[model samples]
Target: MARCGSKACWFGLGMALGAVVGGACAMLVRTATQERVLRQRDAPMVPSDATADQALTVDATDVVEYRGFVIHVFCHALGMGRFKALCDIWESGAVVLEGGGPPTTHVTAEESRSAAIAWARQWVQRNG
Candidate 1:
């Protein structure tokens, strides 16, 4: 039996206590990280034709030519419940107009894309 007053006995007790505390801390950290990952995984996801392994945030990016002006629109989910859209109008290889619509809690990226395109078309009609 180790004497309670011995340095070696106290050192061993300290080391054992440290190991137990360290192990408990590790378990807590691991559990917290797992819960965070699970929460993100369970969040609403953007549907796509692509495979699950190929996760894409930007669902639509397309270019359209109208009246010799090119309209470029890009759309993506802001938070899976909201969406954002940006647009550019180019003429003769120079960007003539650039803007973005306000983010909205829309369910689909297509809605944002169509709204951006409609805004661009209206601008072209008034200017062209």
Candidate 2:
């Protein structure tokens, strides 16, 4: 019988290697895409007037003081005229609470600020 070291054997080996390499590349791409999405989600929605470090400035006109908490409303663009509202509540220069409202097409800066205030009030009323 002839030896099996023919072109067909090499072709099959090449195909198997190609499949393994392709699968590895696909898995790497999937992992990278998932990590990118997670980073975007965890990123803060910084407003245009925020400081360099994205810190809430007390002098900012958008900053609102409710009860003992200072609420900062940040609007982030979500493409297609949509927006995400983030409410960062601070006490003694430290963020004590963080919350957000439903993403909506309508501008919800004021609504987010109000919600933060209400949350702070309720928290105080319950804790005190």
Model 2, position 119, has a per-residue lDDT of 55
**Cα-based lDDT for every prediction:** 0.71, 0.58
TM-score of 2: 0.42
RMSD over all Cα atoms, model 2: 7.0
Per candidate, the number of residue pairs that clash is 0, 0
The list of candidate 2 runs beyond 4 A from truth reads 1-61, 77-81, 98-105, 108-128
- 1-128: candidate 2 lDDT, tens digit per residue: 53558999888888999999999999999999999898874355555544542322233325667667777666544432334455666788998766543344334434544554455566646652
Tens digits of per-residue lDDT for model 1, 16-109: 9999999999999999999988886335455464343132244337788999999888765545356666788889999898764444434566
In the predicted model 1, the residue pairs found to clash are none
Poorest lDDT segment (10 consecutive residues) of candidate 2: 52-61
